[model samples]
Target: MSPTLTFALAGNPNSGKTTLFNSLTGARQHVGNYPGVTVEKREGRLRAAGRDLILVDLPGMYSLTAYCADERAARSFLVEEKPSCVIDVVDAGTLERGLYLTVQLLELGAPVVLALNMMDEVRRRGLSLDTGLLARLLGLPVVATVARLGQGTDDLVRQALEYAKARRGQWKPLELSYGPDVDRALGVMAARIEADRFLTDRFPARWLALKYLEADEDVIVLARGRGPTAAFLEETAARLARHIRETQATYPEAVISDYRYGFIAALLRRGVLQRTASPDRLAVSDTVDRVLTHAVAGPLIMLAVLFCMFQLTFLTSRYPMDWLEAGFGWLGEAAGAALPEGLLKSLVVSGVIAGVGGVLGFVPLICVMFFLLSCLEDLGYTARMAYMLDRVFRAFGLHGASVMPFIISGGIPGGCAVPGVMAARTLRSPKERLATILSAPFMACGAKIPVYLLLIAAFFPEHPGMVMFGITVASWAAALCVAKLWRATVIAGHSTPFLMELPPYRLPTLRGLLIHTGERAWQYIKKAGTIVLAISVVMWAAMTFPGLPPDRLADYDAERAALAAEREALPDDGSAQADRQALGERLDDLDNRQTEEALRRSLAGRLGVALESLSRLAGFDWRVNIALIGGLAAKEVVVSTLGTAYDLGQAEPEAPQALSGRLAADPRFTPAVALALIAFTILYAPCFVTVAVMARETNWKWAAFAVVANTALGFAVAVAVFQIARIW
Candidate 1:
């Protein structure tokens, strides 16, 4: 049987590698955690030349040295799998940085096709390349194309297949000098090493030996000569460190890195024109950053933009939201009237309509947020954010990119700290990554919306947008504080350089956008399908339990008539008309009291009361406490929880005691307390499902940390917001 052609596409981070992967594979790709870890494994197949090409788009990496999580993941695959062909996808515009990875791939001694992606950008910038010379110097076939537009991809794929079928081995990469002493040491080690057999015919054994010379973590895993190997590596690292210190020249890895850059500079100088101006990518980004990332005006603009988004979410969504609520309520009411007052009616009203309606109410919010975020991402402001804010983060020993995930997620209701931590995978250094991961929970996620909305309505009903702004800003503020705290205490490391890629600013793709919007919509729909259905029924049952004994009050009234004659006879004075109005009000008051009292006795209410201990520090009253407990099931349920707790019948409009009105009157929901609740909601633990996803996407340790840290942060921030607001 013919072997499957394995093709590896390697590139620098943010070179549109994943985008290219998605475009190529589409739905053919299957995503999963990489062997016992939350790091995702991306593999797909594309047929070319009547043979299956098993394509593995490796995680974007700065280098093959494995200093970061993504780098390590990529390196492991490259070394272990030894794929049939390696296609190094270099951003044509960012040629210099992208080519560095290309050089590293060639050193692996595999068949290589250099995919020069984004060629249109290069051409548009009035830049020209001698593709022939580049190929001749690199000793490989180089295909220039724009990956995003799907230009030249078919040809690139075909070339990859040709190389794979022929099993071509290209020219060796230019040697990188690690200083004379390092070379001498590598020579001596190579001769003494017995692990040479396994590495032979694969990557250069001498390169493996050279890595031991630099003590590169990526190469040591393939090492042999067991007992002595460990000791040798340790000793080598120590000796190298001493030499780097004594000579003041730096260690071998640093030396080699400089050499590689030097080599690249020389090659570019030979063929590429020297432009006095900056690359268009950077130029475009800098122009925009001047306005968007301005120190004095940026925050104001961000606030203004966010205000518009909030207005869009609430104002634009009202029509649809009302329609959804009314439609669902009518459906439930109709079904209740038609079906018997049993499981079937309950299922339609509570399990299906109520549950789905809750999610549906938030559809506009999700769509608006996702649309804005996608625009922010596409406009290249996200990259600029890194450049602007990373300097501040550096004081806390973290990268600017770490700020991207926080900033993007902070505004959105679904921004869970778990992915915030999972996003830490992009940070190259372990300490910085851990610090960023540890701090991400401070940013509020989407799931906190119900709590935010409920408390905001209860407290600051007039300034919902400002309340949202405060909540959003507060999460980031807390994140910065937490990052600083962790950096000062637990994490100690030198911050890595923040290398950001700013794509040419352009209008977002229409098809790509619809696809993105649809995916987000589907996320809401899918959540409804799973969590909402079950929780709605369960909540309905909780509120309905100990029901009013099927309204036997008529019989009770007949019995009461026999006993009311004496009281009525005494009440027939001139005050009867006023007394009747008073009685009417008293009857309304009694019904409300009865409904609330009965709700408290239900299974859900009892659970909320039990969970109140956890909310007491945050100043959540029993009702708020119950909402929080119910909220764990799904954040949208916080509204539904209020609807349930107030015993507003099966729907929001049916209940005579509007929770919103009650919140307006309640003293416990002061402005400060309301603001505090929003803060807590913004920073608190994600819903149960997000927590599970975080555990799956990252690790159980990270997942558990997200919950513990977020809950603590929420409590602390809420208290601080209340206490400070009271005085200020």
Candidate 2:
């Protein structure tokens, strides 16, 4: 009958905090968004020592400065929610850098239990950490852990629970001395804060004073509304900042940082940590980085890795993809046979089955690609990719941080643009961030993957892998080029310097990879069954209604009857087989003409026809135009829409053909047209959700620009490709 205690999990990027959380919670966790924010939140439940516990995984942050959204979210949660205890996970091998955030958490007055992760890495590097002595020096319990293998997790949890129960939601702030002048200023600020009871219910007095000294924007804004006491604190902070700038040629924030690090150094010097070998010794990561990060070889190796990823994705997924296609085909055929010929039958077989089925057939390929990309990420090579590409990014007027947004937006061919656009918040430079947001959608995301796979299979089946690699390369090329143009024109600004910490390479765990891959693949499947299905049904209605006039249909019916009667009369004898075959071909031709005429008169077909004049410049006919229009809603809809359009037009409905096969056999579709369509799909506007996210992240004006500009660019590129390929 005890209440569930809440524990906040906090750590730096790549500190193995996530691994530890996964280890502790296993499959008992769920992910959601923080209140009123797009940043993701993870929460899990557990029972230990017969006490129910809730673990909240805060976003990975370097410090609680609240400069970026991630930091702000973490800081706000700690300040407002008042979690029972914070488990600060730190990289034991790099204790100095890792403990920076720990110090901030301590200053914030949160009850913290230090989980020193990566101890195995420390031992491998011939480093020694004295846990008991360190704990004593910091006056906090420290548990050494190897999170990936689930080592020390139980003990860490026990220590956290024991510490949380003892603290009982009470926070004791750690006050560090910032020399004489600043110490005097802090004394003035802290006393005024405590006396006036200024925001102390949520934050500790000294901690608020420290944030004021740091000029934390979130805190300052809150302080502004607290009346006269707020003015007094602001004046004191401003005076101290002016004095520090005059004397030290720096600001209070810098001084405060130095003192904090100085305090940590003093603590570590008391025999808390030691190195068995020289500090300059090259570790495994550095040794490997010599080759992996080499200027000349790195880019080449990255391309080879990407090529292999695509090759493996296509090769390994072929059998499963084939099986899915066959299953869907049979289902569609069965539905067609069971239902009478009418709107309901078409809706079930062509609209729902064919449309959604086309997208679901590529699920195995998406899963394989996602799994491989997750492997690269967990192994820490993705960071190196960003590091290596930083130079190229800068040349194109993008910050090094932009590489991640691009990667997440489908730079690897399976990422979603919504999160990718949100990821642009990490960029400090506004111009670079906006450019990244606009250009990221150029990557071949999972939605676009089906479109690519369909076209590549239809026209370039001999080397689908190589063709896919080419498409990926082309996507990157387009993004970089557009970014450069933006930088040189409307969004012109000086590119900020890029600084990133490359985590040491580690073997990815199978469990972690599977979980990550499964989550992403499930999302794709769910979208196919939900969004794609609904849109497909709507498209089917649009393509089916206002049927060819009753008289027109009667003419086709009479021709079909006459042909059938002739076939019935002649098919009895083996010598008359040729005559019967000619009659059947004539009936099929009449049916196809009727079907095409009906489609041309339908609503969606009319809109497509209206756009065909311009679309044909890029080698797209009315049918392709309809699919492309549907792509505005979602890139995957392009595939599903095509499936529906082709199914409705197919003369031989008894034997349903795969979309790829149908496209390949269509007279209007050729290698040149397929290439143009692929190019267009890659460069067109992102899905509706991505556009909404972009609008939320920036504004509707920019989001509108992304749509208009990208579509225009896509069309222009498609036209050039189609024209040039035709000549060739």
Q: What's model 1's TM-score?
A: 0.85
Which pairs clash inside model 1?
413-445, 413-446, 414-446, 415-445, 415-446
Give per-residue CA lDDT, model 2, range 6-88, as digits (tens).
99999988899988998899899999888877678999999999999999999888888886777888888999898999999
Model 1 segments more than 4 A misplaced:
168-188, 194-203, 218-248, 272-282, 290-319, 322-326, 329-356, 396-398, 411-414, 454-461, 486-504, 546-591, 610-619, 648-673, 693-709, 716-728
Among residues 3 or more apart in sequence or in different chains, the pairs in candidate 2 whose N, CA or C atoms overlap within 3 Å are none
In model 2, which regions exceed 4 Å deviation? 26-32, 195-197, 225-247, 276-281, 330-345, 429-431, 487-492, 562-580, 654-656, 699-701
lDDT of 1 by residue, 464-497 (tens): 7777777777766777877787777756667778
Per-candidate TM-score against the hidden true structure: 0.85, 0.92
